[model samples]
Target: MIIEVFRANGALLAAGDDLARPAGLTSARWQVLGVIDGEPRTVAEAARTMGLRRQSVQQTADSLVADGLAAYRDNPRHRRAKLLAATPAGLRALADVERRHAAWADALAARLSPADIAAATAALQHLATALDQEPSA
Candidate 1:
């Protein structure tokens, strides 16, 4: 079951990458944009939210800034860790991907009932929680 879930997640990420491609984004970049949509966050915060390493997030965020998709601002809470906010270009890109994702999700939802999706979501959350509690291998 765990392996199946992992496989499903990989497939989902691949689909997301395809959805984001038209907007010049990969799944990882889209995820970072989604995390900082409304509220700006430091690289560490975004990393924690995305379950990624801070160094990786920082590298991605820097690339996003260079590409004019995102910008870093001074953070009042953190002296060194700057806050990342989406530029207009980033928002536009995110909006485009979201539209595609929504349409794809709607088509799938039409086949699978909402209750089933909710149950699957709950099950995934439970599994994530269990994994979180486990010690590093």
Candidate 2:
């Protein structure tokens, strides 16, 4: 299951890259944009939500800022850890990617039985829960 998950992750990342490329964003950048689309959050917060390292998210946020897709705003609660928000352009780009992603997902899901999909989802969740509860090395 773990090996299959690794393979699936790689395939999904490639698909994400393809979906985001036309909009001038990579999978990582689009992911960051999506995270902040709902509401502004600091880099550490976003990283925790995504289960990624803070530094990686920070680099992606910086790139998004440079591309004008996202901007850093003052966090009233935090003095230095500013919140990241998607710009108008970022939202538009994210909408584009989401449309593409939905279509792709629909097509892929069409090939599988709904029952099978649900079982797979539940199994993965169970595995994730067990892993999360495992004692640290």
Candidate 3:
């Protein structure tokens, strides 16, 4: 199951890259953008939400800032940990990526049974919940 999940994650990342490329974003960038779209969050918060290391998210956030897609704003709560917010350009890019992804997902879902898809989704959600309950090493 874990191996299958690993393979699925790899495939999803590749697909996400393809889907986001038109907007000049990689899977990592898209993931970060998705987290801070409507409501901006700190880098550490984004990293924890994505189950990724803070350094990785920080590098990705830096690249997004360099590309003028995102910006680091003053955080009223934390002085050092600024919030990562999406600019107009970044929001537009994210919308494009989302549109493309929706089309791709719709097409893929069309070829499969709806019941099967629902069951799979439920199973994955259950697995994620169980994993989240586990204590960190």
Candidate 4:
């Protein structure tokens, strides 16, 4: 089960990366922009959302900023930590990626019946919950 899940996730990530290349972003960079699209967040907050280390997210955000894809703003909650937000170009890129993602998801869903899709989604959610309860290494 674990291996199957990992394989699926790896394939999904590879597809996302391939789709993002034309936009001048990688899958990792796209994830950061997508997270900040809903609201501004500190590097730590984004890292936590992505299940990544703060330092890694910080470096990703720094690169995005340098590439003019994202920008940092003053965070009221933390004096030292800055909030990350996507720039106009980033938003445009995100929109394009989101559209492609939706189309891809729809194509996949069309292959399964509604009931089958719902069952698969529920099972995946349960598996994710179970995994989340495990102790971190």
Candidate 5:
């Protein structure tokens, strides 16, 4: 089940790459933008939300900022920490990717019965919640 989930997600990520390329963003960068879309967050916060290491998210955030897709905002509450937010370009890119993803999801869903899709989605959500409650290694 885990392998199947990975395979499906991997395929979706691969298809997303094509959509992201025109915006000069990669999947990792897009993920960061999506996370920061509604609110700004420190690199650590973003990493934790995405289940990634701080260093990895920091590297991706740095690249996104360099490309003008994201910007750093002063965090008055934490002098040493800066919050990340998506720039207008970043938001647009994220929207584009979301639309593409939705279309792909719709096409895939058409191949399965509604009941099967609902069951799969519920199972995946249950598994994700269970894993999230586990202690970190």
Candidate 6:
């Protein structure tokens, strides 16, 4: 199951990259944008949320800011960890990718039942939770 999940993750990332290409984004970049969809977070927070390393996320966040897709704001609680927020351009890019993704997903969903998808999602989440609790090597 774990191996299958890993394979699925790779496949999903590839598909996500394809879907995001038109918006001049990659799956990684899209994920960063999505992390701050509702509210902003520091690069560390976004990294934790996405199950990624802070340094990698910080590099991507910096690139996004340079591209005018995201911005950094002052953090009242943290002096050094500035909050990362999606700019209007970033939001627009996300929306564009989401619209494309929705259509693609709709087509795929037609081939699979909602119940099956829900079950798979639940199982994956369970695995993720368990993995999160495990000590790193």
- For every model shown, what is its TM-score relative to the native structure? 0.93, 0.97, 0.92, 0.90, 0.85, 0.91
Q: Which predicted model would earn the best TM-score? A: 2
Count of clashing residue pairs in every prediction: 0, 0, 0, 0, 0, 0
| lDDT (tens digit, per residue) of candidate 6 on 29-68 | 9999999988999999999999889999999999999999
TM match of model 6 to true structure: 0.91
Shift in Å, residue 18, candidate 3:
0.5
lDDT of 1 by residue, 36-115 (tens): 99999998999999999999999899999999999999999888989999999999999999999999988988999889
Misplaced by over 4 Å in model 6 are none
Clashing pairs in 3: none
TM-score, cand. 1: 0.93
What's model 2's lDDT at 91?
A: 97
Worst 10 residues of 5 by lDDT: 15-24
**Model 4 stretches with alpha carbons more than 4 Å out:** none
lDDT of 5 by residue, 1-137 (tens): 88999998898788778767777778888889989999999999999999899999999999999988899999988998999999998898899888877887788889999999899889999999988899977
Residue-level error in angstroms, candidate 6, position 51: 1.4
In candidate 4, what are the lDDT values of residues 1-137, reduced to their tens digit? 88898998899899999878878888999999998996989999999999899999999999999999899999988898889999999899899888887888889889989998889899999988988898877
Scored against the true structure, residue 57 in model 2 reaches a CA lDDT of 98
Candidate 2, residues 1-137, lDDT tens digits: the string is 89999999999999999999999989999899999998999999999999999999999999999989999999999999999999999999999999999999999999999999999999999999999999987
Per-candidate alpha-carbon RMSD to the true structure? 1.2, 0.8, 1.4, 1.5, 2.0, 1.5
Computed on alpha carbons, the lDDT of every model, listed in order, comes to 0.95, 0.95, 0.96, 0.90, 0.89, 0.96
Off by over 4 Å in 1: none
Model 5's lDDT to the true fold? 0.89
Stretch of 10 with least lDDT, candidate 2: 29-38
